[model samples]
Target: MERRPAPSRGTAVRATRQGDAVSAALAETDAFTSAQDLHARLRAQGAAVGLTTVYRHLQVLADRGEVDMIRRDDGETVYRRCASDDHHHHLVCRSCGRTVEIAGPEIEAWTAKVANAEGFVDVVHTVEIYGTCTICAARPAT
Candidate 1:
């Protein structure tokens, strides 16, 4: 994994109230939530943040490696607060939108070997597996 530069002290101190609110909201859940949904949640909590501010803060957090963004099958982008500092991947449930964090040493080795074989340097990769969870799969057809 490529290391990102630590945020400057000034940058850390300059975090806005809206950004803090957004971060607090995100930290409350492990689900991949859309910006609209997050805005609604903030409003429910009596926060005065707007949808645009939520999106902007989320973008900054994603860029800073503090959050992860993934696309659903419907093409909507969702954001989640990453729980781990070490490298990992997500196993996402298609029906319920539940996510599980997983680490595979073999997958890491394979990725590095493939990248080296292709003469690629400083390679980074993302892997997300999607399937129905047991509970979802066991449900009867509506």
Candidate 2:
């Protein structure tokens, strides 16, 4: 097994702050965020944290399964804390960078149906839908 690096003093500080910030941030917004974006936004929102600290904290949270880092088609990894204890999917707005949470039993049923029909067993699915959001659509062209 690979060994993990020892946590530095800064890392420890960030870890504590990140936990608090992540909780507060999630409570305040419905949008998904990447480390870079979160760093910028948090700073703008007066968090007084650095970019490196944000990235490190994000990695730690992701490793612990406390947050999900989703890599978009453009290669940016966005993160969102899991809000529910059950399985769910997301609808992402490409234009406004918004995300919607969705959950239903019908999705589970359909996944079982399709997987069995295709002769596959023990399958899992994660669905993400992307489209323009209302805010983006209503905005004037640049």
Candidate 3:
């Protein structure tokens, strides 16, 4: 099992029941899920969390780096509990919202080289590759 760092002080200090439920839901999945999907799942499980509350909790998690947020090809945002604290990129399935975490030493080197060339310091970046998965690609076109 992977170990996650404890939340810093002043952020997520008190985990409300709703927040706990939301976190539990997120912990159950590795795929990227939208707020609406999470809300529906919680409702199905008899959790008394509203959609707005789910969105709020997800935002808090993202802000604290506990979860990763990425925009889909359709421009909808999705959230997933981060698997690691280390820097990584994601390959996302546009159809099913599945995600694969990847590390690229070459990409990191390139980013640093570009930053230095542009006279930029303290650079940060996000990379998300979106495409159809095998299942989605194999299906007949709609």
Candidate 4:
């Protein structure tokens, strides 16, 4: 497969077959997945896309806020298609990798209050909460 140079940050990434394939593969799963994993899945589905291409597409999507990424405890970044374009937080299941998007009005207010108290300007933030879900917690002792 021919390779294209990686798109620069904030560059407008036009749609292509490979990029569409990557996004389609991501939409098939609700779990956040690694680039290698997504590449494998694309191959399994007979999509002619490479791992590097997967990474690049994911990076572009993430830059556009079209995807959500999380760094696990081990430091691997995983990507998932965004459910909402609006600002929100994620509650991730540590055991199953399930994610739920949520808004925190109180947290937003608190962030504003704290930042204002310090006279901070142009504040931006992200919040992610990780824990085992009820199903994962209910399984019999392994």
Candidate 5:
């Protein structure tokens, strides 16, 4: 479990307070969710937050590294809780839009080695492995 980056000062304060509806909403959700979906969930939770607020909160979280903001192939931004330990990656299911977390020090080392071999420094990698999820695999093909 890769440790998530720390929340911003603003978010930190909010997550500590009951009325910090935005932070509370985010905290209650699964690791992977869209900001729009999160806004809907917050509304359903009786939080007085708006889509704009959700977006802003998500930006702050992203800046602080508490979350991962990914761009799907279709150009949608998705968010997920950054796990603990700083040693994880994602296994994304293309069919069902689900994501799984995976971690291995060897993978990280390999990435570093590849980057170094290519004369790349401080390289940031985004690796999305696409496949059908178990649910999708188990279901009868349409």
Candidate 6:
């Protein structure tokens, strides 16, 4: 078993088969996926994992900043494997769910400036841009 150091605040996550299964399933997809959908897929594959476990583990991973999370317009939350460890945003294809991780230095500077001007500290932010990707744009509309 490969061991990693504990995260900040003295919290440790023990490795488990179900957690490994969730990570593996997530890594298999390039698109963001709902936890319920991922749970169903794992059950279909005979992963022997429960929905609650999936949710719990995903929250842990998200809190650790090991995954990217976004909320759809209809309020559905989704998760995807992070492509880069550095601070970045996401460009998502609305029709196809394809996602690209990107960095926006200008946005970062703007946010910092705004926050600091208001005397805010410890500011955190997330930005996700959704639009049709090239392939989706090329397809004929139904």
The predicted structure with the larger lDDT, 4 or 6, is 6
Of the candidates shown, which would achieve the greatest lDDT relative to the real structure? 6
Query: What does candidate 5 score on TM?
Result: 0.74
Encode model 5's per-residue lDDT on 22-122: one tens digit a residue. Answer: 66666664446788888888788777777877887787777877777788777889887755537577887777667777776677888999999999997
TM-score of every candidate: 0.84, 0.71, 0.85, 0.88, 0.74, 0.88
Please give, for residues 16-132, the per-residue lDDT of candidate 6 as tens digits.
899999989999989999999999999999999999999977887887778888899989999999889999999999998999988999999999999999999999999999999
The runs of at least 3 residues in candidate 6 whose Cα sits more than 4 Å from the true structure, single-residue gaps closed, are 1-13
Q: Which stretches of candidate 4 lie above 4 Å from their native place?
A: 1-10
How does candidate 1 fare on TM-score?
Answer: 0.84
Clashing residue pairs for model 3: none
What is the per-residue lDDT of model 3 for residues 91-131, given as tens digits with 9 covering 90 to 100?
88878877889897888999999999999999999998888
CA lDDT of every candidate:
0.84, 0.73, 0.86, 0.86, 0.71, 0.90
Going through the candidates in the order shown, the clash numbers are 0, 0, 0, 0, 8, 0
lDDT value, candidate 6, whole model: 0.90
How many clashing residue pairs are found in candidate 2? 0
Relative to the unseen true structure, what is the C-alpha lDDT of residue 106 in candidate 1, on a scale of 0 to 100? 80
Candidate 5 colliding pairs, count = 8
**Candidate 2 C-alpha lDDT tens digits along 23-96:** 46655656778777777778888887788777866776667656666789989888888787578888889876
Between the candidate structures 1 and 3, which one is better when assessed by lDDT?
3
Kindly indicate the candidate among 5 and 6 with the higher TM-score.
6
